[model samples]
Target: MTNHIIVTIGRQFGSGGHEIGNKLAERLDIPLYDRNLVNMAAEQMKISPDAAEEVDETGLSRFLAYYASAPVDYSSYYMTNIEMGQPLSEQLYQVQSEIIKRLAGRSSCVIVGRCADSLLADEPNLINVFITASKEDRVKRIVEKYGLTERKAAERIKKIDRERRYYYELHTGKDWGSIESHDMLLNVSAMGIDGAVDALEALYKAKK
Candidate 1:
């Protein structure tokens, strides 16, 4: 394994990104960070993990303002001494940012999404990857995994990709899932999930 490796995977919905990350982490014998980041960040923020998870993907509209420094009690549920009026998404981003940096500093790990590639852009030995798939394959995967009709699956994928694009662009100012944003890009519909992981693992070793 490459020393001090940090592989960040930005993926399209139903592209098997999480599965790829998990396999890569296992093969590298390192921990994987995915939706669990929400819990970790929520814990640091002294809030319920469920609360953070709600805004993790789709984002929050009810709460506005990310002024952690201002400390105004605009809403009781959203106010802690340092969290008053803070936007849920941004607040979560700040905490997760700290955690991501700490994890990267500690040792090798695989991180999935949450704008991690951009967050750790300055870190050493980091491999930023974008995973994409054909729309037909993605829709089929979504339909099978979630028991949705093909049309609903397609719609969900669009909604999810839109949310991901908005979130990633909002924080990183880089085009989400663009060639410029990543060191490597893989089409899982072409290579398959395990095949993508295999290719990425080889790339990770060469990154040294």
Candidate 2:
């Protein structure tokens, strides 16, 4: 068995998806990628990691992403917002896709967020899993972890999920949270983090 499995996890905010990914990576002795993807993209583009992270999932904050990959007149360009445009977002997106593909080819790894599933769709050995939970469960988890009130937790969940959905839809042209988009759609509230990891491991082994 040549470490060929590529695990992609899309999760609800505060659902412990990253924790599960970490556990899975440790058990499999492979690398786990989440925030690190942004860092890598930043290094590749020679920009600040914070800037890369700002658009980690979203292609572009403005309409520029839609117009990217086309010729632009840089001769009269200045460092203004419109002039800078979506070049950075486009470049970061490309770097992220490349890094995910490179990691998929290199070894078995657990990738959390950034639409790794769609990015590595060409890899025949990839296993895409979506982790989600009920709104109430997610809110409670968020409140417990971040010390936010129930109302605030609910708002945070909605805001984060909205961004994730927008980013996924824009980049992949696929509906986020749809069962058709993932090989496995799991409810983290049902099994918790450790149990979910065990179940996922078993499922992957069965597939192998």
Candidate 3:
């Protein structure tokens, strides 16, 4: 059966979530939106991609009050913010959310991070996924990937995971990796990338 499904992946830093997403998208012949999302948002907002990257998935506590008070016209919110001189972080979020919605409406795709799960929560065709891995496995992957010592890899994992958790909670008011937050959670360490991809593809087929 042909499936039109939007897979939103929330993953820990060292988890093979990105690899899985790429493989799944390839298998399904669908577009994969990851860091390219930042570029897309930046282009729409008429800002440098580097500017968007600065606040990508990082909490904005100091600017939340201002953002909360802004008038929200979902139709043109991002453009409105550009005209209103909103902070870059707020602008990026608004633009990216709009872009994600537009992309979902246009086609089924796999979106990695940037709170795509929560942003598209109301969509009927959405599949929310969270990817995690054992700490030891994550550390090992990080050490190998970055040529870092085990201790440094462990530290990096903790810091990135903490930032992800904080950003997710701040934006969605939901626990980052809590089982209840997602339609499915996969442990990359247990299943490995290819196995995880197969499982997700199977799940999508079943759901469709």
Error of 1 at 48 (Å): 1.5
| Per-model TM-score on C-alpha atoms | 0.86, 0.83, 0.84
Let me know the TM-score candidate 1 reaches against the reference structure: 0.86
Model 1 stretches astray by more than 4 angstroms? 1-3, 59-84
lDDT of 1 by residue, 3-87 (tens): 4879999999889999999999999888999988888987887787656765675532212223123333323245334536676
Candidate that beats the other on lDDT, 2 or 3, i.e. the better one:
3
lDDT of every predicted structure (CA atoms) = 0.81, 0.77, 0.80
Q: List the residue pairs that clash in candidate 2.
A: none
Error of 3 at 11 (Å): 0.6
Which residue runs of candidate 3 sit more than 4 Å off their true CA positions? 1-3, 58-85
lDDT of 2 by residue, 1-208 (tens): 2358888999878788888999988887889998888888778776766567556674222223222343433231122235556556666778888888887888788899887899888777788999988888888887787677899778777777888898899899998989988887888888888888998888667766
Local accuracy of candidate 3 as per-residue lDDT tens digits, 1-208: 1235899999998898888999999998889999899889878767665456667774322133233464322323223354677766677878898898889888789999988999888887788999999999999897877677899778778877888898788888998999988888899888899989999898778767
Best by lDDT: 1
How high is the lDDT of residue 202 in model 2? 82
lDDT of 3 at 115: 88
